[model samples]
Target: MSFDGEQYPGVMAPPQKAQGFRLNHTMLRVKDPEKSLAFYTGIFGMRVLRRLDFEEMGFSLYFLARLDDDEAIPEEVGERTVWTFQQRGLLELTHNWGTEDQDDFAYHDGNSEPQGFGHICFSVPDLEAAIAWFDSNEVSYVKRPEQGKMKDVAFIKDVDGYWIEIVQASKMEGAGR
Candidate 1:
């Protein structure tokens, strides 16, 4: 079906109560914090905004974001923690204790049989440059831009095997047409 504003109920008439609501973050369970952190920070250029550890629960939560060039991060831990949750487009990685030690440990990538979650997308300014960057880092690809029917889009796998959809808005002029 073609794009239609009235296709979904309540979408055409948004609720007033949800005016102030905004997406804070998306959480993903990871097997190893070090590997996941490296992929997110080193590859994706995200900064570790805040890290919360729960020794009693045997898990940890790492909040990350790709802050603006001139954005000033809070110096103190409490301030940083507060500031992190207030921002949009943040990524939270949760790691359960001892999962890294289990050689067979793996998280559902949401792209295989019995799929549930699909993928997270990143809109890059330059799709070519981003693809080259991924190549330079030897990032595994789920689909190259030219490989699929969706010529303007691409997908790459992260350290935890999660699919990351990459796109350039300008390149997708008539993507679904």
Candidate 2:
């Protein structure tokens, strides 16, 4: 499979070698921890798996994951840290303590002039239902499911202006790069 980073225009699966490697997480530099945390946790239903603070660097990292079962997450710090790294496809939010106070603080969203990174994708069980829920919650959608050529694919923007693709698990084919 040739993954080319274009939803519906490339292979959805990664190469065989990629199978041996797991994507632990994607880190996003957030401006406001409160807003970013609320958006992901409230809308995406991702729970905080771990939190790391660097006082010297004046920054913090929040690891989040989507839980499907009642499996209790490790409570101990060391156990949770180990378990957090074992999970695949987790989201990490990095908050620089002073960014919230900076008037011009902003991270490259990988969509404009210098696009270095692409959007993250989430596979939902029901595309229609998820879309309805997003609409009811007044979520900012860059592209709705039925609006583009790829009817089953959609894109929503996070609080920091990062794009997130939402697709139904049943329609996973042609929804990735």
Candidate 3:
């Protein structure tokens, strides 16, 4: 949908013209690959669509996706690498080798002083059930529903301390039956 700031009778005005570009993925650096992988693939049910290791660079890239049965995921590594870039919404996790051993290792979550980046959200069919699942898996929560002003919303923290907001799909804006 291209919008040149033209107004439609039943639609809201676009703030600016869209450039028709798609978001491929959001990258996050992880320290412990095993822990991060377990959290994303085991607990969250996301499949590792692609895994690329640069041995000389001392880092690896893992692309994950929440795919359905109808979707086509490549089997061969070369085709998978090309296919991974084609999807719009995928999570890219970069594991820098040897970083997990540093005693003072940490990454700025962008929520502290001079805050900039916020959180990534996931809409669930049942927010309560999702919260329970997270709890069952011993995942840490940044903000629970009952503790926030927005009682219907909740936030959980990933292993690297990145926030993930959880919202009820049926209750969220623009969601319908």
Q: What is the TM-score of each candidate against the true structure?
A: 0.92, 0.84, 0.84
Pairs with steric clashes in candidate 3: none
Better of 2 and 3 by lDDT: 2
| Regions more than 4 Å wrong, model 1 | 1-7, 10-12
Q: Which ten contiguous residues of candidate 2 have the minimum total lDDT?
A: 2-11
Model 2, TM vs. native: 0.84
The predicted structure with the larger TM-score, 1 or 3, is 1
Top candidate by TM-score: 1
The candidate, 1 or 3, that scores higher on lDDT is 1
* Backbone clashes (count) for model 1: 0
- lDDT (0-100) at residue 136 of candidate 1? 99
How much is the lDDT of residue 60 in candidate 2? 100
* Candidate 3 ranges with C-alpha deviation above 4 Å: 1-20, 174-177
The local distance difference test score of each candidate is 0.92, 0.90, 0.84
